[model samples]
Target: MSEALLEGGTRCLRNVLGRFATGVVAVAAADPADGTRAGLVANSFCSVSLEPALVSFCVAHTSGSWPLMRGAGLLAISILGAQQRAAADRLAASGTDKFHGLPWISSPGGAPVLEGSLAWLECTVEAEHPAGDHTIVVARVRALDAIADGEPLLFYRGTFGGFSR
Candidate 1:
């Protein structure tokens, strides 16, 4: 066996990382000052630590909506169900009415909590770190709940699929 170092560039790195499937979740927050809501779909959401009940999600440096979340004292995460591809797509798109026609409610902490989510986590920013071309946001869970029971939407190789699909 021989090991040869090859340069695959950014696309290769992304494609290699995409080999690991991850669950899709929407990380949303509302401006406590003005009541404006911002949401974005992310596949990088993950549980970071159990002792402090912390979670981490990565937001690209180019994300225009990520800045809006900075003012949020609380952020809400919605684990999307298998049937909610439209909701996921809506949140993933840019410069559109992401909340339009979607059923959701505001958490007591002021985060917009979407309806029909498999699970929900209302959190507050604990710490942030600058990672390469993305920002690693670590949040501490304040309130957590599972509103529904079902399979979640899985993203693999840059596409969505599930067990039954």
Candidate 2:
């Protein structure tokens, strides 16, 4: 195995990467004192180390909400289902009210777990690294659950789609 070849530039690279589908999830947290919520949609969520129960996601370096979530006591990941594509789109946008119409619940640790998620995981930030234009966030899972049983929302070819077959 070798590093991905990007001979065609970023546009070509993005198009190439878009061919690989991924599930989307919302990473969020709340400051209980002031009721400030920080969240963003990410398709880069995945498990890392098993012994320590580590999970990870990559956030863009320019994400405004991530800064607020970085120091939180807990961060919750809501794996979006087929019905939550709107939430993903809203959260993925910049400088907007992401939770305006969305329903969610707070974890005992103060992270917001979106309603209707396929699965959810609550964790504490373990480490962060600068990777290209994104920040690699590694967290240790403290609590997790299989929420609603359903197909996941997928991102592929620069669009949202549902799983089939």
Candidate 3:
């Protein structure tokens, strides 16, 4: 494709991808020393392995929490349920007490596992690659749990919804 076409193609791709629904997840981490921690809602997560246990998520290069989470040594991937959109929004906010009024349980690795999620997966960053305006983070799952029975929160066309069947 020509350069002009490539730019237009990217825009088209973005619009096309928006039509596909995705599950929401929160990638959280804690600093064991000072107990400082943070998390953010992400619709860009997926399982990558099972034998060695691994998963991956993408974060915008400009995210402030990415630096903190990278330094924490471990991250908690909290798969949000359809009812946890508020939790997602809270985490997605910047420069705020993201954990305020949030209910969570502590993992063995000291990460916060938010309650009422479809599941929680604890991981340690194994690899990070710069991908355009985002960073692709590959983590090795350290600990996890399918803690609840519920439908996932879905993101599509800039809105939240859930499966009907």
Poorest 10 consecutive residues of model 3 by lDDT? 1-10
Q: Which lDDT tens digits does candidate 2 get at residues 40-140?
A: 99989988999999999998878899888886668999999999988898888889888888899977677899999998999999999889999899999
Q: Is candidate 1 or 2 superior in lDDT?
A: 2
User: lDDT of candidate 2 vs native?
Assistant: 0.89
Give the per-residue lDDT digits (tens) of candidate 1, residues 17-128.
8899989999999888887888999999999999889999999999988889877778999999998888999999999978888888777677988888898999999999
User: TM-scores of the models, in the given order?
Assistant: 0.92, 0.93, 0.92
The number of clashing residue pairs in each candidate reads: 0, 0, 0
Best by TM-score: 2
lDDT of 1 at 79: 92
**Positional deviation of 129 in candidate 3, in angstroms?**
1.0
